[model samples]
Target: MVIHQNFLPLASSGLPVGKIYLGYLFIRPVHNPETPFKMDVSFIKHWKKRTTLEVGHRGMGNSYTKCAVARENSIHSLNKASERGADYVEFDVQLTKDKIPVIFHDFHVMVSVAKRSPEKDVHQIAVKDLKLDQLRLLHLDHVQHHSNTPLNEQVIKVTGENDEAEDLRPFPTLIEALQNVSTDVGFNVEIKFPMVQEDGINECENYFEHNEFLDRILKDVFLHGGKRRIVFSSFDPDICTMVATKQNKYPVLFLCCGANTRHQVYQDERTRTSLTAVNFAAGCGILGVNFHSEDVLRDHSPITKAKQLGLISFVWGDELNDKTNVEFMKKTVGVDGVIYDRIGETELRSSVFMLEKAKKNELFSKKIPSPVQTPRAGSVHFLNDQPKIPGLNLSQSVNQPHHEWPISSSSRRRSPTVTTEAEKYFAASHGLIQLNQGYLPQQLTTAREV
Candidate 1:
């Protein structure tokens, strides 16, 4: 079991406080004990003070409803989002018939077939039924209500002509995306699981087993994720549960329709409302909740409630397309992240993560001053004239005698190892220690002053 201690600032409420108060501690039990890997989740959780992260939905934007530069979930779209300054890009991932995870939004694709008639006939087929090779060969089009009618439209092209480049083509594998997309950009992978809609209809029938499906995708991510920031989200509560328990490497977010009038709600009770979603996420030790825009706009109390529970909140939906709504969510509601379409359409901005990284580099790159001479013999002085590193306790080092400083046994055999105050500050700030074992006490006791 992993116990996460979340410290929140309490100065705003006018209460007597130290630097920070222990807001809450949540326990996440390991369901798959055999899985040995664990990940640091501080990057996603510790973003309240920074600017709200902007994520490009389905990479630049969903191509079905709105006109997009490239096909949704294509490599072209993902790179476009990275170039446009999105902190993270959200895309849908589902397995093909051969269990190859591919990036696609819908469960079915429209394929054009030529027959005796002069016009080509269109047929709708589930993406899971087709192999990877067959799916790539077929000229795909958007699924239509009238399948009998002959329409020669291609899904990738905005205009009437089929002039899309290879990168703009759909059905790119999950591995392909991990390899080709910008390493600086993060990825919000939405697991495509079949769910029961509000109207007693299944989104897709006879899908792969939940465990097998999730395992396949997780394997691909673990093998190729490297240092990229990644988060897994799903509307299905079961999928979210499995994702959280199966591996501790990535954070899982419960996607909620959240009492919205815009779209049909799923039959699952957890996804029916944002409040219930928060309750479920908190109870399950899940990282956060991604609320639909319609519900939060109507009553933003859910976001406040999420923050109170120490759960990160992100807003998504078609309503986020409007720049005004995006600002309201970011400034007024104070969401951790926002997923929208047509990123950089109004204005281009650098990622908040990248900006913070640059600042850290600039701050650390400045040369440190040499140790100053002390009045007394066998004494050393530091930081008297140098800029102080944040979170570093310099007083302890300055007051202690040079010979009395704690040194590791290995240092005694060789030259004395110097653990700089800046190194300690950076280690603690970046969560270099193991998270599942608890960090605060361990970092304090183990990090000795040199």
Candidate 2:
């Protein structure tokens, strides 16, 4: 048996506060105690058999050409994704002219003006040319014409004509996003690197150095990311190499747009084929490759080759908007995970699929191992004194001093009879004062009065 312990601080609640000791034990079953187990040879395909994680694309979903309530890449949309129960939230991160990293998807945004002049008010402006302050003052007109869609149909009215730039939804800084988002959910941060044009010309005249760009994001992640898991991905191979070489904190994934993708076709070696992408990722010691869904649908050979090379595989594209293709990728194609625009809908569908399979297995009396909650016995004492709560596997319990006990689990389980008494004892011992709501010890919060 293997056990892991997490230490967590108690949240603010109605009950009185004192010294709290909590331990969260995760118990795993082992086949053999002495022998070393063989590694999983199937690579990421094994994850497909288990639960398929739902990743929110641009927080819930982004529709630049269509009307949307909460603006894409806003803090509100990020919170909405968390509320909808997304396993991971993916967002684009780019650098401004002033060297500030912000969360935005498009390379440029259209600014609306009250009066039209010869300056071509509808011209698309690059995000890198303007500072954060200048970008904030402009009105965003998120509209783009699709091949099959009409020009007028692409207009999405996001804000009022006279609204100030600050009043509109401004891009969120990297620090703000890292600090404000939920701690439980993971983040898939895509580092935006402009590509060379198909005619072998640079798209942007000036940009940040490769090392400087990668370091800026790394600084924010190390300082504010806390314990949240982060996976770094980018279309530029140089960015992947830099991330892998610079830091070992997070895993790096190479995002590819193969030959069949509708995305801008490039003459570069890496983006032209899926095979090259897998080879490049494996050579650079990258964790995986996020292939365009169209490429995977055309040929699953790249996925199989990646598995053989011990690399993870993921798929994303507009083709995944269809429900049938999502199922096909999960069940037939056997990818590790799929990124979709609609997070809640995909999560619900996957749950239903699992439920149906479980029902079929139940008819044959197949045994399934499900996680059973251990009773609430969360105080710290010496080894001789065990917790009074029943149903605890003391024999398998590994002794650890600091462990995080979930407040949610504590609420569900039976309460400790000594909870109030313990609080009072600690409060008296520490000379704590009764605050507005409850008795708070000086060590808890930094507030002056409470």
**What lDDT does each candidate get?**
0.75, 0.64
lDDT of 2 by residue, 153-247 (tens): 44455443454333136578888888888765678899997767466655455666665666777777767887676788998776676676555
Candidate 2 to truth, TM: 0.62
Model 1, position 268: C-alpha lDDT score: 68
- Candidate 2 lDDT for residue 99: 80
- The TM-score of predicted model 1 comes to 0.71
**Local lDDT at 284 for model 2:** 65
Model 2 residue pairs with clashes: 6-403, 6-404, 7-403, 7-404, 8-404
Best-fitting candidate, scored by TM-score: 1
lDDT of 1 at 56: 97
TM-score of each: 0.71, 0.62
In model 2, what is the error at residue 300, expressed in angstroms? 1.0
Model 2 collision count: 5
